[model samples]
Target: MNQNSKISEDTIDLKELFFSLIAQWKIIALCVILSLICAMLYLRVTSDIYSVDAMVQLEESKGAASAALLGDLSKVTGGFGQKSPVDAEIEILRSRMVLGQVIHNLNLNLIVKDNSSGIMDKFLSQGRSRLTYQHDAVTFTNKQNSLIIKQLTIPEYYSDKPLILEFKDSNHFTFTYKDQVVFNGKLNQKNTSETNKGLWAVDINAQGELLKQSYTVSKLALPTAVKNFNAIYGVSEKGKMTGVIGLSYLGQDPEQITQILNNVLTVYHQQNIERKSLESKQTLVFLEKQLPELRKQLEDSEIKFNQFREKYKTVDVNAESELLLKQNIDLEKLKIELQQKQAELSAKYTNDHPLIRQIDAQISEINKKIADLNNRLTQLPETQRLYLQLYRDVKVNTELYTSLLNSYQQLKIANAGEIGNVRIIDTAVEPVHPIKPKKLIVLILSIFMGGFIGVLIALIRNLFQTGVKDSAQIENEFDLPVYATVPRSPIQETRMSILKKKKSIPILAVKHSDDIAIESLRSIRTAIHFALSSAKNNIIMISGPAPEVGKSFVSTNLATIFAQSNKRVLLIDADMRRGYMHKYFNLEVTPGLSELLSQQVSLEHVLHKTNVENLDVISRGKSPTNPSEMLSSTFFKELLETLSPLYDHIIIDTPPVLAVTDGIIISQYAGVNLMIARYAKSQMKELELSVNRFEQAGVKVNGFILNDIQRSSAGGGYNYAYAYTAQKDN
Candidate 1:
């Protein structure tokens, strides 16, 4: 059978996973409680902040007619110009020019705090000298001398008390209540060989005052101090898509925050309007210059047209006809002259030549124009009608000029009437509540983050552990049956109560508790027996991937169960390295498995009785060098062979297979090898490797024992409870 087929296919049991987490519910609860406490403390310590907001809107400067004019101009030139109104307005709002205005007007640097009050400022005060010196001098052989001096000065702001000077050596100096001091020292020695230089020294009084008066030099120093304070700025938080804009400020005084925000908003609005008005004024100036020029051009065009009409007033039909005939004649003459030039050029050069083609084309165009002029004159009613049309053209020209002048004047007037482009949409108001440091949200988020991180850590740790965890994982990977599952008993304190109350002949007869986990183990035991089928000498060797997976516990309990059924059973503590079966059996560890394996004693001599009937245990006798080699020896095999025939069932508790290969070596002699995997403790890879090692060593790993399964529901342990209750009633 395939590995996967050995275990039934079932959906992931979410309840089981949840139960595993629930078992560690204390950790989860602790994380949540701690997070809530921290959040509460944070809320209490944080200062509340208030906010205000202001709004501005941009309107298009030009009306619809200007838009139409621009469109028409684009069509005429086949070129695009200027952004649409909305895009231009958005750019204007974000422009550096507007922001710079806001910054300069508000002096934002002075308003925003870059640093808090520093530690040095708090402890150190102005004008106070902390330096100390001595009042004695020492002379050296090289003529270098040093004098000890002491200086202590208080701030000038001290009131009522006159300054006093105290010296460490009372005989060195005396001081008066007035700002004066008397120095007592050895007199200066005058040098006869060379001129002596005067001594220079400094003195300080107790009132933090310094005085130096001399004919050659004088010096006085005073301390000047300024208090350090924190600068503040407003801040606000608003939702991403919310129309509301929040504003807040921080300062030593609450009223200062309010005043700053109010002034900033007022300046922002005024500046926005002023910028628009300036642009409108610039446009008006350009229009004003253009309007006067257009008007002058219109008047000049009308005057010229009037003069032409008045000068040509002499109208005669015959004379006008003669003039028209003469003009047509002049056109024909010019066409003939052009043709003559072309004919001459073509004869001297090829038609493809530039000069020849230019001459020929020019001649052709002139001949067509002459022909068109002759046809128009023939179609006309008479010369008198032609004269009348010329007179009407002059009148039409004058009228068009007058209309253009009137339109220019009107557009100029409209441009001068323009207003600011931006308007105030809303004004900032004082916010009712703070927009930040949300206590409830912070607590909830902290709890979620803690739990998420905890689960991640648990899973990562579980993945890396090299031990067995569950029977299903082993059976699916190794094609093995699960022989049994053992629930972990509560610590000894709880088990002692049950033991004392039962007072039974066989401790095994003291019914196991009906906890949900225990009931699940009964189901596992049934499955194991079914897998055994027809195998003879149902001896089971229980071991794990590592130490402390409850292998000893499983072996003892299984053996006890068999004995309770009236079948002979032996529970052997085969772990020589660290065995504790003697303690469980209430017997000495001497003369046990090690003595028998070494041929120092017989197996019967080492076997001991527990409080239960029909069950015996062989505790690890003593420590031995190289337990693996001893367990793998022929004598051990012989011992197992002798015991197997005598007992109905032999349950051996061996050390973890992976930790020491002795379990795999011993399993070869046992009829059934059952691996014990502790839930949430053993890893999947180690279990697979252990099984592979057993298979390679030619040991038949019959099944696994899944131990310490946590129970999530009350129904889970019901069967175990029912069995115990039925036994009690019987």
Candidate 2:
């Protein structure tokens, strides 16, 4: 909006930005300290987590033929083709069934902890429990037991509250808070009851039922146990197509995580073995059904052979027939086995598969042996050949039955000895150190987070602010030359503050002559002398854009400086509504401006001489209901014109220009209108608007006084003391 502000818009002012940040180092430091304290508390309260991991390799079976049992695993774990089997295995490893078994075997759902003290520590604790849960009394002392919640269940309503168990005897106890019983129950016995929250069922652990212990034990639901275990368990392949699955789970306890991962692997291994044996069991069932038919066929063949021998009265067979019968019996058994192999292979593989081709070749070899036996059989007599045929039928059935029985026995052994395809490459070990809450990383992030929050707070404050922080912006925007930049006077600050609090004002020119503010006032005196040399009168009016912009302060000090320079001056507090110029000198507030303007007092009675030589004061005599009308009256103009010849300069301190019409009405009578703008307190728009009001009233605003310019850090913007000292020393 202002030329100085517009100049900053085209290019970012790095110096201002840096100084603004420097100005708020305390905010940044506070944020960082608070953040660090929170971070330390977090690290102290949070339990450390340890990672226990196990590696397993799901080696693809070479020729398993167990497809009926172990199907493609990829569908379960997510993948296609070659990746499916391992993924499926991984899913099974993390499945509810496997996790439930692990939880049940290890008693993982029995949660116990000491919660008798502070709520925060007990609630957030994942560390080793203070009260150790035991199955027997020999492991710990039982005589000093105070409270024992053998079993407890929390419903939704009372989930956040603690159950205080007050032990009365070994077999009896009560749930109480502040020594009042909420519920009564006996040890070792299961009981279901209703409370204010919900229904609950509980029982003491069976092994430790007889022992009295001051501890709490809670059994988690089966589904919840499985879910918790599943959340902690993780499985993934080590590398693409590597088939090396890495299984892990991290928790507060080293032993717990180690046991958890080991249990998961053990369950998976057992399940795999059972799955692999399923196919063998199905095939065994089918083979058992054929055993009876084979036995009957053998029996019938034997009866026919015996009957044929009796009817033929001892028909003789040559050695060739015997050899042929033996050969046919062996060849038939081999052929039957090859056919069975072919049938089993057809279920999983194509006709051209290696296993089928191998079986077919074996069948061909057996067929050749049968053909050779047939050729030799033709050489025997017809009767012997008939006996050979019957004998051959009996032999074939007997050999086939014997071979099938042996094969069944061998398959039973194989099924019994089945093991999982997946092998444990590395078992989980108890970790020596935790994996979480990296201290260095947390501290670094906390510092950065603090800085980020500080910047956001600064930005938000700046966004809502309309105050001008720079003095140049006032001159550029108001089209007024800044006569002086008054540095905050530390020398007179304490004394002036005390005087103001006592309903008086300090005279800085007499109290501290070399003060920075007084030096700037002298500068203003010189600037005004040159600027108003051609003016019609020496009566100058001082006002501000807003109240409390040090307008009274500027009027008193400048008048004092001019009087000290041997020029007669009168400082008039023209703000009839609220002005205090008599506070600077020891004089009464009445018999001043209001009395003079209202014609209630004469000019000599209204004007009061101050302690400073050649300087006189006129205070705002009384508060009037219609200040605007009174300042606009002809009496005020006549009073000023009447005193014009006596004083070298008549300085009138008026109320804020934009606040009321007093400054605008009085500015028309003055030679030059001057306004004071406090640093970082007044806005550029207010300065521009206040100047515009004077120009509209046919009075040209001479310039601005940027008052109370605060000192800044060295190398920052507008550190006048540092610059002045540096120049003086040079």
Best by lDDT: 2
lDDT of 2 by residue, 1-730 (tens): 5564676657755655564555556677788888888788878776678899889888655323333222342132132112238778888887777887876666666555444435475456544243332222111112343223344555554443445544567667666544566667776687678887778765543224223334444456777777777787788989998989998897876876776688788888888777666556666665687788899999999999999999998876667666667768867976876565555445546889866787788789888888888887777778887788888888899888887777677666777767657788999999998889888899999999988888777656655655765666765566578887776676655565456556666677887788777887798877898877978789899999888788877888899999999999999998877777787796778877887777888888878888999998888888878878888988878888989999999999999889899999998889888888886678877887887788788889888887766535332235442312100000
The lDDT for every candidate, in the order shown, is: 0.53, 0.71
lDDT by residue for model 1 (276-344), tens: 344334434444554566456556655654565577666665655566555555554444334433443
Best by TM-score: 2
TM-score of 1: 0.47
Q: In candidate 2, which residue ranges exceed 4 Å CA deviation? A: 1-11, 37-47, 63-84, 106-185, 192-201, 205-228, 279-327, 335-386, 389-418, 467-478, 485-523, 556-573, 576-651, 678-685, 707-730
